[model samples]
Target: MGLWATPTLAVLPSEQLKDPALEARARAVSAGLRCVVCQNQSIDDSDAPLAHDLRVLVRERIVAGDTDAQATQYLVDRYGHYVLLKPPFETATWLLWLGPALVLAGGAGGIVLWLRRRPTAVPALAADEEAEVARLLGDNR
Candidate 1:
């Protein structure tokens, strides 16, 4: 762990809010936001313009007297649930959360089908049908 040891928030000098408490709360909120630019990195750890904008937006919401939850919800309302690092389990995200499980179950069923042996010899032709064939062929040519 070196320069990357600490999460690199793109908080510019001019953008650092004066109130430490408010800034701390903003950072906490940012930690749960997914950076649209980085995709995988949290906004708290991204320097992308969108990440910076989101951070500022969170702070602005806090200063406007919105509670933390409200501020977060505001972002969600704007960006869709994809902006949240941990999206809630709901109809919209059921496929995202359960897609892999469904695929695995389907593959297992396929494998079981492939591994099973086929029916050996077409129902054995029935006992009477076998006797008829024998008589048609004669006792022994």
Candidate 2:
């Protein structure tokens, strides 16, 4: 593929609904759903068999007269919140959303504490050590 070439989508012509409006809705919903097999990709962008199945399922739900919310909820009901690309901020998902910030804050606090406790100055040499250094240098009065 050329450097600027866009990757082809997995949505085959046969999989698209006859109704354009419904197809658009299906695409929108597919964009929000994650591919179980390709965990990092949305169903719309993934070519995995599971992603194809999910794409078909979303289209089917849209054609069945389900509202966008209802269709999305149906998938959530079957697959749990993991299927959502952006999961809701609830008790179960709080850590997923907040864990990075919490870790960063902990790291920053540890660095601050270390800096505060570290030694800042060198101690002065004792009188005997200074006298020895002068004798070694052959200093005389």
Candidate 3:
């Protein structure tokens, strides 16, 4: 009844099973996989053929005795890390993880530089205005 559960199995007939445990594992793994075609969606929620293929591939690898990490690693290797819902923090991913902070720092530095270069406001008084102000304020002796 929730947004995540529509009871729709997009797998092939041969992929359906009565084993709840395998199905559960499949769901668990699939839910953490990103759909290459639909970047924002997990394979479980995607109806794309590539998503279905990835789902089947995951089930196949799991049934073949690959651990969850192994299966995920296989997908990551095959898809070049783009298939991972959560990319690992490594040298290759450092920029992706730190991009926002870097951008913010750069923006702050630019603002500071701009402020430093900005001209100071100087009040230019006309001859008459200057005399009036001097008279009202009592000119310094």
Candidate 4:
């Protein structure tokens, strides 16, 4: 309703781990995971059923003695890097990390090439045109 309103979290009381530490870790992991259905919202924020499943999965992994990274990795293995809000920079993901910079460089190169090819000199006015201008000034006086 208001600007900057906090999102209603999709994390239900039933899904939370009994241990506060594990619940905190699960929430942290969920915050970094993208909801496959929602795409843009994190699993922690998305209300979709798939997001809820992923949230539960994260808690399950944490309670099963997996570290935060391992829990995140489990999802990543099953869902691929798309599940991570920030994917790792790897051979398979090099383009994702560098594509913007490549585009910017290409645009900059195009501008430089266009500048070099642009005509710089202004053509001089003809003698008759200059005389007509002088006559017009005389008439105005």
63 in model 3: Cα distance from truth in Å?
1.0
Off by over 4 Å in 1: 1-7, 94-141
Whichever of 2 and 3 has more TM-score, that candidate is: 2
Candidate 4 per-residue lDDT, tens place, 9-125, comes to: 578878978888888899999999999998999999988998998899888888889999999999999999989999899999999899999999999999999998998787887
* Candidate 4: residue 67 lDDT (0-100): 92
| Predicted candidate 3 versus true structure: per-residue lDDT over 56-108, tens digit per residue | 99888888888888988898887887787888889999999999999999999
lDDT of 2: 0.89
lDDT digits (tens) for residues 32-52 of candidate 2:
999988899999999898889
Provide the overall lDDT of each model, using Cα atoms, as 2-decimal numbers. 0.86, 0.89, 0.84, 0.90
Ranking by lDDT: 4, 2, 1, 3
Residues forming the 10-long window of minimal summed lDDT in candidate 3: 1-10
Collision count for each candidate, in order: 0, 0, 0, 0
- Tens digit of lDDT per residue, candidate 1, span 1-141? 544665554676577679989888888888899998799988877888888888888889999998989999998998888999998999988998999999999999998888686565666788999899999999784
Error of 2 at 53 (Å): 1.2
Pairs of residues at least 3 apart in sequence or in different chains that clash in candidate 1: none
Off by over 4 Å in 4: 1-7, 98-141
